[model samples]
Target: MKDFKFVSKTQETLKIALINFALLLIFVELGSLGWYFVKHKQFFYTREKTQNKSDLGINLEGVRLNQSIVERFHPFFGFIQQPSADFRPGFKVNNYGFISPYDYPFKKNKKNQFIIGIFGGSVASDYSIFQIQNKILPQYLKQLPGLQDKEFVILSFATGGYKQPQQLLILNYFLALGQELDMVVNIDGFNEVALSNLNNKNQINLAMPSIQHILPLTSLANNSLSTKAMQTTLRIQENKTKINQGLESLQHCSFAACDALTSVYVQNLVNNYRKDVVAFEKERGQNQQDDEGSVIYINKNKSVLEDSAAFEQMAWNWAKSSIFMHKVLSASNVPYFQVLQPNQYYQTKRVFGEAEKRIAFNNETPYAKAVELGYPALLSKLPNLQKNNINILNGVNVFDKTKDAVYVDSCCHYNKAGEVVFSNYVGSSILESLRKDEARSKKK
Candidate 1:
C-alpha cells in the first residue's frame, strides 16, 4: 500500500511538470508570433508608401549598385543577354545597356581624348556634397586649359568601407571590361586597417550574400521605431513647455522641471552614442576571423591606447597593400595615382595641439608614413618601367591641408570648399602629367 501511494505521487508530479512545460512553450510561441506580426505590419505599411514614390532603384546604403550590376553581368554569371533597359540615369534604352560607367557618354569632343578613372572609398564617391562640386578630380580636369577640348570622363565608383584588396579587385574588373583609361586614381587609407583587422576572409565571403546584404533592413526597421519614439517624446515635452509658458503662476516651477528633463535627455543621448560605439567594437571583435577558420581573438589584455604597436602594424599593413596596388596598376600599364584624404583631426583647430597629435600617433596615420617612405615601396617596379619609358604620378600630397577643410566636427571627407580646392589641385596635377607625357612621346 505504501509503495502504491509513492508511485502514484511520482506519476502525478511528472504529469504536472509536463503540463507546465507545454504551457510555457505555448506562451513563448505566441509572444514571438505577436512580435513578428507587428514587425511585418510596420514594414508593409512603410514600403507601400515608398512604392508610390520615385524608386531610388538600387541600395545606396552601401556601395553603388552600378558596380554590382556590372559584376552580375560578367561572363561568369552566364547571363549574356542584353538588359531590357538602361538602368543608369541619362541613358536611353538599348540592347547593349550594360556597358561600364567608364564607357558612359561625355560631351561630343573635337579631337584629343583622355579618360581618368577615380577610385577610392566614400571620399571618392562624393556622397555628402552636390554632384557638380562633390568630386574634385573630374570637374577640375575639365577646367584645365589644354584639356578643355579633350574628351575627359572621370569614372568614380568608390564606396565607403572598401579595403585595398577590394580596390585592387575593382581595378582588375574595370581593366577586364576593356576600359582604356588614361589614368586610374586610387584614393584610400581610412578603411584599410579597420577592415583588415575587423573582417576576415569568411566574413568577407558572407558579406556579399544577396539575403545577408539585406541585413541593413533590420537596422532600418529598428531606426524607424527609434525615430518614432523620439518624435513622440519631443512632442509631449513641447506640449508641456507650451502649457507651462501659458500658466503664469506655474511658469517658474515648470521651467525648472523642463530644464532638468532636457538635461537628462541630452545626457541620455551622449550615453547612447558611447554605448553604440562600444557595441560596434564588440560586434566587430566577435565577428573577426583568423587564417585557420577561427574567430580572431581581440586582445582584452590591453586597451586601445596600450596596444600602440598593433595599431601601427595595422596601418603599416594597409600602406603595404596600397603600395602593392600601385605596383599592380603600374605593371598592367595602367595609369594610377594615390589621393590622400585627410581625417577630421588632421584639419581641425578644435582637435589641434598635443591631444589630437597623441590620438593620431596612437591610430598610426598611413599617409604621414607613406610620405616618409617617399614612393619606393609604391614604385618598386618603376625602375624597369623607366627603361620602357613609362612613368606613374603620385597625387598623395595634393590635399594634405594644415588646417581643417571639412565641416566642423566632421572628419576625413571634405566640404564643398575643401572639395573645390582638392579637385583643383588634382585636376592641375593630372593635366600637367598628361602634358609631360605628350611632350616625352613627341620627343621620342
Candidate 2:
C-alpha cells in the first residue's frame, strides 16, 4: 500500500510539470503577440552587415528606391539622379540631381568663388564626390597657382552609366537653370564605348539613357508581372528585403533574442538564393522585356543620326558632344577638359600588382571585348578633338606605370590611390592650361 502511494505521487508531479511547461509557452507567445499589436513591428529580429557579391552593377535597395534614384526617367536629360539620400554613409544627393552634401545650386556663389564642375559616368561621379571633395580640393587642387585666393565649390553633375551627349545635356540643363562654373572637367569614353551598345542598340534607341535606368521602370510599370523564373526572383527579392528589415532593427529590438550570427547566416542564404535566381533566370531565358509603355526617348533636337549605335558612331558622338560642350563653356570663359576615363581591360598595357590581379579584373565581364575593340575607335578621334581646340586628355594609360593597386573592382571604378592619381594628373593639367591662358592674355 505504501509503494502504491509513492507511484501516485510521482504521476501527479509529472503531470504538473508538463502543464506548467505548456502554460509558460502560452504566456510567452501571448506576450509576443501583444507586443506586435502595440508596436506594429516584428518581435523577433536580427542584425547583419551586407557584402555586395553580385555583379548586377546596382544594389537591390537602389533598385527599390524608385522615386529617389533610378527606375524613373526625366524628360529633359534622359534620366536624372533625383536629389535624395543614398544608402552609402554620408551620401547626400544635392538638389541639382548630383551627389553632394550641400545644395550648391542655391549656395551663395561668393566673390572669387571658383565652381569646378565634374561631368561623366560613375568614375567621374565618384571622383567628384569623394576624391575632389575630400582629397584633391583640399590637399592638391587648392594649393595650385591662381586658386590661392579663390574659395572652391564643387559641382558633380555626373551619373552612373553616363555617355557622351548625356553629359552634354546635363551641362546645358544646368546652365539653362542659371548655374555658373569657373571650370568644367568631363571624364568619359568608357560608357561611350561599352554601355552604348549594352544600354541601347537592339534594346532601345542608341541615343536613350542607360538600360540600367530603363528596365526597372518597365518592371515597375508592369506591376511586378513577369515570367515564372522572374516571379521566383521577385519572391526572393521580397524575402531579402524582409530580412533586411529585421537586420535593420537589431539595435532597437526589445527582445533579448536578436541573434547577430543567425542574421548573418540568413543573409548568406538569401545571397546564395539571389545567385541561384540569377542562374535560373538565365537558364529559363527569363524574358526581360522593354514593354510598350516602358520606353521613354530623350534625344530631343535629334543630335544622334543612327538608329543603332556602333563603335565608330559612339566614338563620333563622344567627340562631337565634347566639342559642343567646349564651345559653350568657352563662350562663358569656363575652361573645359575632356578626360577619357581608366578601365581594367586596358590594364594589359601595364603590369598589375597582386592585389589588382585579385580584385580588379574579371575576364567574364561583357565590357572586356567591347573595351578591346571599341576603345580603338575612341582613340582615333583624339586628333580630331585636338584639331577642334577642345582640350583633351587620353587617360586610358593612367594606370600604365603604377605598380600600386589602383582599380577597385572588376568594373571601371578606382580606389583611393587611383582617385588620387587621376586627380593629380587633372590638377597638373589645370595648372598648365591656366598658365598658358595667362601667357596668351599677356601677349595679347
Candidate 3:
C-alpha cells in the first residue's frame, strides 16, 4: 500500500511539470507576437499597392528601387532618378526618368527656356527637408524683373549617396540623349568625403563593404546584448531623472558607452527595418557597368596615404571630372557650376538641438571621421577649380548667417528653413552668373 502511494505521487509530479512546460511555451509565443507587432507598427512604414501603373501614367519598364529610390537601370551611370514611391508631394516624373512636377518633355522646349539641371546627392535630390522642385524658390526668382521674361525649367537629376563622378555620368547621358541644359549645377561634398574615407577606396563607383562585413559578427552579437542590458538600466535611470530634475541624464553610462550603444542601435535598426530586397530584384549584371572608362583601381601594394592626401586625390579626381563635364556642356554653350554642399561637421560654432545633439555625439564612426578629416582637403582645391575655368560655388559657407538650426536628421541634410537659405544662395549666385554671361554677349 505504501509503494502504490509512492507511484501515484510520482505521476502527479510529472503531470504538473508537463503543464508548466506547456504554459511556458505559450507565454513565449505570445511575447514574440507582441514584439513583432510593436516593431512593425512603430518603426516600419510599409504600404501595399494594388493600383495599376497605367492609371498613374508611370511606366515601370526598367525601374527598380536599389536603395529605395524609384530609379531606372541606366547602362552608363548604374542608375538614374525616377519618381520614388517612398514619399509624395504631387510631383511627377518625365518619361525619361527625370523628376519634374510640370508636364514637359525631356528635350529643350525651344521657348528660349533657361534649363538648369541641378545634380548631386540626396540633399540636392529633394530627399531632404523639402521637395526642392515643389518649393517657391523658383517662383520667387521668376518674380525678379531681370528674370521675368525668361522661361525657367529646373530639372533635378540627383540621387541619394551619389558621388561626383555619378553626376558626370548623368551629364554624359544627357548629352547623349540630346537634351540641352543651360546651367548644370552639381551640389556635393558630404557624399564624396564619406564614401571615399569609409571604404578606404579612392574611387567612387566601387561598392564599399557593408557594416556586417566591417564589424565582427561575434562582437556585434555580444555588444548588442550588452546594449540591451544597459538600455534597461538607462531607461530606469531616465525615469528617475525625470522625477528628480537634479539628476544628470548620463548618470548610469558614460558618453562613449552611450555612443557605442547608439551605433549598434542604428545598425540593428537599419537591418531590421530595411526590406529584404535584392538589387534590381533580378540576377546581378542586369545593369551593365557604367563606370568603365573612368574607374582606375588604386594599387594596394603601395603604402596607404594619409587620410588628407587620399582625400585630396579624391577631390582632384572630382575636379577632373568636372572639367570633363565642362567640355561636354561647352559643346552646346551650356554653363556649369559645382556647389560644395554644406555639412554640420563644418559648422564649428553652431548650436545643436536635442535631435542634433544625439547625432553629433555619435560621430566617432570611420565614415563620420573621414568626412570631417577629408573636407578640408576638398576645400583647399578651390583655387584648382578656378584655374580650370569652372565657376564653382562655395556652398560650404552658405549657412553662416542663419542663427537658426540648419541641419535636419543627418550630418549633411538641412531643414526646409535651411533649404530656403540654400535656394536663395544658389539663386543669387546663378543670377550673378547669368548677368555676367549676358554682359559678355553684349560685348560681342
Candidate 4:
C-alpha cells in the first residue's frame, strides 16, 4: 500500500508539469503575436487612415513595361508592331506596328511626295518621333536649293532592337509593295553590335531576331510542361498581380507588409511558385532536345560572349548589310545614307555629369564592354561602308563638346537635347552634301 501511493504521487506530479508547460507555450504564442502586430500598428499606415489610396495614388507609368504590346512575326522582317495593344491613354501603335502614333498609308495622294524613310533601332525611332513632332530635319532640308517645292513626309521604319539586314529587309519589303521613298536615312551601329553579340551569347543564329524577340517565345514551346505550368502559373500570377496592384483588399491592412498573416500566405505561395518555375524550366530544357520541332532553334555558328574575332565579323556583317542596302536603293534610284548613332560607351566621347553617370553609364553592362571592344572593329569598317558608295556619317563626335547630359538610358539612347543635336547635324550634313554635289554637277 505504501509503494502504490508513492508511484501514484509521481504520476500525478508529471501530469501537472506537462499541463503547466502547455499553458506557458500558449501564453507565449499569444503574447508574441500581439506584440508583433502592436509594433507594426505604431509605425505602419492603417487602411482606415490611408483610405487605400495607394492604388489610385501610385504612378507605375515609368516602371510599367510594354508587355501589353502584341507582337506578330512578319515574313520579310522579323516582327512589326501590331495595332493598339497598349492600354495607356492616347498612346497608339501604327498600322505597320512601328512605334509612331501614325500610319504608313498605301496611297500617296500628294505629287512629288518625298517620303524620307528613317531606318534603324530604338534611337532612330526616337528621332522619328522628334521629327514627326517638330519637323526639324525636313525644315533644314527645305532651306536648301531645289528641295523647297517638294512635299516631304516622314516614314519611320525604325523599330526597337532592329539590327542590320532587318533595316535592309524593311527597305526592300516596302519598295516591293509599291511604296515610294525618295531617300533612306538608317540610324544604326549599336543594335548591330550589341544584339548580334547577344544572339551568339544565347547560342542562336546571328541571322535570327534578338534574344529579346525570341526569349519570350521559348517558354510557350515547352510540350508537356506548358499545359501543367500554364494552369498553375496562371492562377498564382493572378493572385500575385492582384496583391502587387493592391487590388486584393484585406481587412484593416495597409501597403507596408499589409497583414502579417497575409504576408505569410503570400510568402508560402511564392515558395510554391519558385519551386514550380524551377521544375518547369528543368523539364522545358529536357523537352527541347526531344521536341526540336516545336522550337525554331537552329544549330548555327555561335561564338562565346564578346569574342574579338566575332565582334569583327559582326562589324563586317553590318558593313555588308549597308552595302546590300545601297545596292537595293541604287537599283531603285533612291539616295541612301546611314548615320552610325552616337553612344555613351565610346571612351572620352562624352563628358558625363552625375545624372548621366547614374542613369546613362553602367560599366557592368555588356553594352559598355561590347562597345569598347566591338566599336573599334565597327569603326575600322567605316571605310568599307564608304568604299561601297554609302554616305555613312559617323555620329560618335556629335556630343563631344557638349558637357550636358545627352544619353538618357544606359543602353545607348539619347535624350531630347541629344536628339536635337543629332537631328541638326544629320540634316545639315545631308543638305550640305547635296548642295556640294549639285554645284559639282552644274560645273561638269
Q: Which clashing pairs does model 3 show?
A: none
Tell me the RMSD of model 4 versus the true structure: 11.8
Candidate 2 is scored at a TM of: 0.71
Give each model's whole-structure lDDT. 0.43, 0.66, 0.55, 0.69
What is the C-alpha lDDT profile of model 4 across 1-444, one tens digit per residue? 999999999999999999999897667556545654564445334333443322322322112133322246665677765656562333356778776555664456788667888999888987887787788889888887778888777878888778987988887777878877888899999888887776776666666666555443454543434565456556555644644544244344543444554555644554454445444433333323343555555445634644877788788888988899889989987888889887888786466788778877765566777787778888999888877888888888888888877776678777678888988999998888778768988999
Residue-level lDDT for 384 in candidate 1: 39
Tens digits of per-residue lDDT, candidate 1, 234-297, equal 4434433443232322222223333234334443443343334333323323321222332321
Best by lDDT: 4
TM-score of 4: 0.69
- Once fitted onto the true fold, the runs of candidate 1 whose alpha carbons sit more than 4 angstroms away are 1-114, 127-146, 199-285, 288-334, 345-411
lDDT of 3 at 21: 88
Of 1 and 4, which scores higher on lDDT? 4
**What local lDDT score does residue 137 receive in model 2, on the 0 to 100 scale?**
46
Q: Count the backbone clashes (under 3 Å) in each candidate.
A: 4, 0, 0, 1
